[model samples]
Target: MKTLFLLLLVILFISGNKPGLSQDNNLQKNLGADNKVKIQSIIFNDIETGIVNNDVKKFSQYLSAQTYLSLINGVNGYYSSNQAYYILEDFFNTFKVVSFKIKETKTAESVSYGKGDYYFEKKGKREVAHLYVTLNKAGSKWYIAQISIN
Candidate 1:
């Protein structure tokens, strides 16, 4: 009887420790979230660098198979990766980027977006507009799904 009682106590103790495991799980989840934010920051920073340098090729690798572009040049729709390259190339050729500063980035579920101030010179006139970039995660990696410069 004592052996059975001890076994029961051990079982209860093991079960009671499960809550502690959940705390560890929660800690892991928090760490994972932090890691995700850091990764996004890095990715967005790279994109910002690409814009600042007026080189879409620097960020072309991040484009998804189909990227949506909403631009001031009356271009709005989904485009293939190759198409996006030339499209962005033309855009950069037209409006020379003076400076680009990403304001904030936010993520929800598997999608992350960053809004920035895009300052450029068009026809010798300096102008500014909001640049919004969206990224969607596929598996363990994120890809650029949309870029809107308006």
Candidate 2:
């Protein structure tokens, strides 16, 4: 009897009949299968390049007509695209940008968000800020819908 029970246990183990282990393995496989590639737009590169080069006009061209902007000085509101450009210009003048790079990006349907670091030189000292930009796709083009710096 003991030998028969042991053989049955070996068979179950080799056949992947371990309840929790098989369930966990299936879960992991499902998760891995669900992780699909995300599609991003070329405008994202243009925005980041404009920031790195400190070109206000180039950056502002990506902003939508009604863009929401949140500044570090507690200013948070929606502004027209032209107004947003001026705000960005002011920030570029106040803090000299040394480097800007996108850290991560996520897209859902028609909108994408990119988070990154914005390095600037302030008063002879280097400063770092978290930059998050949201781009919305309209028809066939993507435009900047929101920008937040913290």
Candidate number with greatest TM-score: 1
Estimate the TM-score for candidate 1. 0.74
Q: What TM-score, to 2 decimals, does candidate 2 have?
A: 0.69
Tens-digit lDDT track for model 1 on 1-150? Answer: 999999999999998877652323433444553455355666687789888888887678778899999999889999998999999989988999999999999988799999988999999999998999999988866789999999
**Which runs of model 2 end up more than 4 angstroms from their true locations?**
1-40
> How many Å off is the CA of 71 in candidate 2?
1.4
Model 1 is weakest, by summed lDDT over 10 consecutive residues, at 21-30
Q: Stretches of candidate 1 above 4 Å error? A: 1-37
All-Cα superposition RMSD per candidate: 13.0, 18.1
